[model samples]
Target: MKVIAINGSPRKDWNTATMLRHALQGSADRGAFTELIHLYELDYRGCSSCFACKTLGSPSYGRCAQQDDLAPVLRRIEEAGALILGSPIYFGQVTGEMRSFLERLLFPYLRYSREKRSLFPRKMDTAWIYTMNCPEAAIKDAGYDRVFAENERLLKMIFGGSCFTLTSHETLQFADYGKVDADMFDPAGRKARHEQVFPRDCERAYELGARLAQNISRGLPS
Candidate 1:
């Protein structure tokens, strides 16, 4: 089985990327072919509201019509047995790049009819890994939990498979806070949590990936 992880953070070596790497490592260790894609490295636009994907008798039906860097990535995902998406929360939601990526990835397969919900070719497990500077206790108050749940719900509906979410909270945002004028956060506390809590979060991500691979191998639902 092949497991693919998409990193939606601009910084390739930051928290989101690190968690995704750990997840991919776990998948690879479980005898699954694994690949990691960085969305920022690809030049792509969000869906253009083109109805080609939904138009009857169209060749592009059930597929994204735009041809760009994301085209091949989406095709690769079509072949994957499992997928993981990782992003850092910005302004109470995922980054702009991730939002655009989701638009391109999900819109094509979404059916307008009530009888059928998705046009995706097969059933596959999916997971979302989120890193945020906000504390876990504040997630509900901030309404970020709804965002996460909505994403999971959409993935489950579109792919016809189980979907789960993992979140890393109070993430370290900078290597040296003194270099910037961000006085709203305590740099020392964030560093301490990164050293203590973030490692545990990475371990959780790894376990999530390993479990996904194991389930696929065993013909079990994730």
Candidate 2:
């Protein structure tokens, strides 16, 4: 089985990327062929609402007709057993780049998931991995629930799969987080807290990955 991970972080080795990589690494250990795509390095735009993809004779069904770097990526997503989408929190939600990418990425998947009705026996599973400079309290902020909830619903509707979210809040300092980064979601700048929280986050993520992979192997989804 194969899994594709999309890294929506602008930085190379930062929290979002690290979490995705580790999740894929755990999947690899379980013999899942894995691939990682860093969207920042690609030249692509959100999506053209052009109805070209919906044309009767168009070769691509729900995917955009404007071909760039993301077209091929869509095919990979279709064949993969699972996907881990990692993004850094921006303001109070996923980054624009990641959000746009998700829009484009899900377009074709949405067509397949909704139109192809034989998905009763098995389906793909996807997880969201994220890191932020804010704390859990920040996620609980008054204004953020709607945004998070909307994204969660969109994920489930688009992927025809279950969703698992792993998040680490308050990740501003790389060094501080690295201390416990091997296993947890400790924020970067909070040195003392980093040592305590990072490992747990990592462990949780690793376990999530394992469970998701096993689900695919057993024709189940988490």
Give the candidate number with the greatest lDDT: 1
Sliding window of 10 residues with minimal summed lDDT for model 2: 112-121
The Cα error of candidate 2 at residue 211, in Å, is 1.2
On TM-score, the candidate that comes out on top is 1
Off by over 4 Å in 2: 109-122, 174-189
lDDT of 2: 0.74
- Cα error, residue 168 of model 2, in Å, equals 0.5
* Per-prediction TM-score: 0.98, 0.83
lDDT tens readout by residue for model 1, 1-222: 899999999999999999999998889889999999999999999999988999999999999989999999999999898999999998988899999999999999999989889999888999999999889999999999899999999999999999989999989998999999999999999999999999999999999899989988987876
- Model 1 error, position 157 (Å): 0.9
Residue pairs in collision within model 1: none
Stretches > 4 Å off in candidate 1:
none
